[model samples]
Target: MSRKRKETEVFSLSFLDCICCGFGAVLLLFVLTASRKADQMDDLQSKIMAVIGDMEYEISLKDKEIERKKATLAVETRLAKDSGARLDETKKRRTELEDMLKLLLQQLAAIEGELGKLIDEKENMPTQEEKVPIPIPNPDRRQYLTGFDILGNQVLFLVEASGGMTADTLVDAAEWADKPEKERREAPKWKRVKKALKWMIANLKEGSNYKIIFFNKELVPLEVGFGRDWFDPMDPDLTVEVLNAIDDITPEGGANLEKAFAIVNELPIEPDRLVLICDGLPTLSDSYAGGGNQVMYDDRVAMLRAAQNALKLNLPVNTIMYPLMPDPGSAVHYWRLANSSDGSMISPSEGWPDI
Candidate 1:
């Protein structure tokens, strides 16, 4: 009985020891699992904190944007004033430019006028410039003589289309009718006249009337236009036909000075002038049957009466004489004609020039 009781005690002690070992192993496993779970939780918390930090940064940026917008709106309220200030600056610049332009225009106009005056004075005093004299009407005379009516009432040309002149001389003469006094003086009278004519045609006023009368024996109209010679002298818009026709006048002649003068008598308006352009004394000037030897004066001089009869009740004659040689007879005729109706005479110097 004692041996059996001791055996039972030993078995009980072994069972208790086994139970303690199993419990210690389970406790150790539970501790390890709990520590792993705690580590995973800490990692999740770190991720959540990082996301929170990004969201805070975004929120701060949004706050800054709102403040910037508010500042922009505050500044925009006075847009009208800002725009007006800029506009005023622009307007001031424009005004200054306009004033400068106006001053420049005035200066240009003054210069052009001065040039015109200088051109006019050159005719009276001897100068190379072909400046025609400005004839102010003599109040004492019963005539309608006036200065270069810038209104160029007529484009009358007393051209010397005589066979004696070279083709080049005629061409040159035709082109120089409108030259300035200086240029005219620099060249021959014939060439100067041509230059002057060309100048006139190219620079005539818009409302001026013009007629180109070429004459040797009979008077011939070369170019004609109402208000403005051929085309506006100041501004030309010439037709090809007119330009060709103007350039087509050939130098041919029978030289009856009286015939050209007679053209004035047939004018609808009294007459501007009987521009007697002659390089020499008139050939066959009088009636052949009057005395057979000398030309008759009564018939030739009768033109004066006819001129006086046909002229505007009080228009004077004006003479521009071109002679190869300065003949006393031409001077006498020009002098007589000019004084006969209080006209003026323009003749070349004493030297004889080639045609």
Candidate 2:
């Protein structure tokens, strides 16, 4: 028993010391490893946080760009709408101008129609005044009288200068052998014819054109040459010269009526009116008369031919017939000629040119 007690306790001190030392070394190693792991985890967490911050900054920049684009689009839309409104206004103004143009054209047409109507009315109105006498002053104190509307632009006076004009009456033979040449020239009938011609010259309208054709065997101009046709607004001195020329003419030739009408036809411009002064029918025509004293049937035929020429001319032949004592036939034939030509025939009475 003593020997077993001296052997050792169940828990030996050296074994316990070894166990404690091992346990302390294991605890110290665990603490150092844990520290190193903590440091590595901190580094990984910092890198993740930096990456997330950069992504958030990029998103913010994208959002600002979208807002700027939206504002630009809105401004462009407003400008487009304003332009469309202006275009519509311009179209409306153009339409209004076109309408105004149409209205102006209608007004002009109406005014033209009114002017045409007024002109027609003026042309259609009838005048009451019968005679419009020329207002020229008569220095000879002679009467102013005319049956015709002698207001033509061109007028012709045809005076017959024949041996018969020297007679006391148109039909009676003149006593030319018994009387002196001066006395024969101053015969009352011939004097009256000259006076009438002078009166006509004096009474011519101011600014009127005229011509004198003294017809006997041929047509002869009073003052002007054969080439000259008319005298426009004859001067007083020229008129006096013409009258003197007529006075100097001696009545001797046979009255050739055919030549007178033929001359009228030959004129380049036809006279508007013809004033024919004669005492008898035509004595000489295309040929000589068969007998002297009276107009024969052949002479009448010749006169008829002359009248036909006048008719074809269609110019008004105003006749101033000095009464023939024996040949009432002459008056009747002249009346027929005047009627055919739509002319006027006036036989002077006691008050001669006044009638």
Candidate 3:
């Protein structure tokens, strides 16, 4: 037994070497895995840092944009406030100007009133010599001269008794045209026309022979059937009759100056002067054969020119024009006619011949 124990060994060299090699291999694997993990952590940390840096830059840019918007808002607010102030100033200036205009109008009205009073005083003043005394029927009544010589031995008055004479405007005339004859005769314009005729009759020169022919589509003498006779202005009965007849007449139909002037040819004596009392130019003529209910402006003018040719005698034409709406050309034409005929054209004031 002693001899067998002496030769036996507890461990061998190959087994120890195997154990050491296994330990070395495990250590190497651990070192390699640790190095790879450390490298991956470093890369992740770098990516995280770059992301944070970019987010911080974006936030800074947003802050700068907010500041710029705030600045723009401030500038716009300032401009709006300035514009509002200027608008208020402009409104205030406009108000002041309007007030000034109103004040000026008032002053002008006052001045005009004073001027009217002065004119009235001058007209009412007594004259030393009475060459052609303009007779005032009433002492309190005011009368105005026609501003032309009305001195003629034989005077003829051609009054237009057209529908237009019933009113100042065409619309009103149309309205009145459909009214009753009595109502039409009582129209304000018609009454004024009657007053004008009465005033002229009252102011006629002493010993003068006068004839009145009222014409529309037809010619009508003051006294029917006396179209060719002249009445003495001094005959009080005839004057009253003539006035009464004029008052009774109702204005109707269109004005026919051609027919009216043709009546002059039928007169026993040629008139020394012709007084035309009308609102506007003739709307009807014998020469116009055109078939239409309405008469155009140009047609009316042509009718007037044609009517002038009907006058055989070259007597002075004194026109006393009353206002008619849309008759602008009438004034110029009448004025030219008067100028050419060495006569006067008067558009009397509303208060003239204050009956």
Tell me the spans in candidate 1 whose CA falls farther than 4 Å from its real position.
1-152, 164-192, 200-206, 223-235, 239-244, 273-276, 284-314, 348-355
Sliding window of 10 residues with minimal summed lDDT for model 3: 137-146
lDDT of each: 0.53, 0.69, 0.81
Candidate ranking (lDDT, best to worst): 3, 2, 1
The TM-score, computed over Cα atoms with residue i paired to residue i, of candidate 3 is 0.58
| Residues 1-355, model 1: lDDT tens digits | 4565444465587899899999999999999999999999999999999999999999999999999998888788578679899889667656644554564476568779999999888657765756697775765333324422223355455565554332224456445444543444345444544543453344444665555667655666765445333334432234322444545655544455555555655656543433444554454332222344554445434433443344443444555556543234556665676677665556644342211
What TM-score quantifies how close candidate 1 is to the native fold?
Answer: 0.42
- Candidate 1: deviation at residue 249, Å? 1.8
Candidate ranking under TM-score, highest first, comes to: 3, 2, 1
lDDT of 2 by residue, 142-189 (tens): 211336544566788888877777764634545552566577667667
Model 2: colliding residue pairs: none
- What count of clashes does model 3 give? 0
* Model 2 TM-score, 2 decimals: 0.52
What tens digits encode model 3's per-residue C-alpha lDDT throughout 133-252?
767774311212337545688989999999999888999999999999999999988888888877677667898988888999998887723543477766654554565677888799
Clash totals in order? 33, 0, 0
Residue 129 local lDDT, model 1: 59
Q: RMSD to the native, candidate 1?
A: 18.0
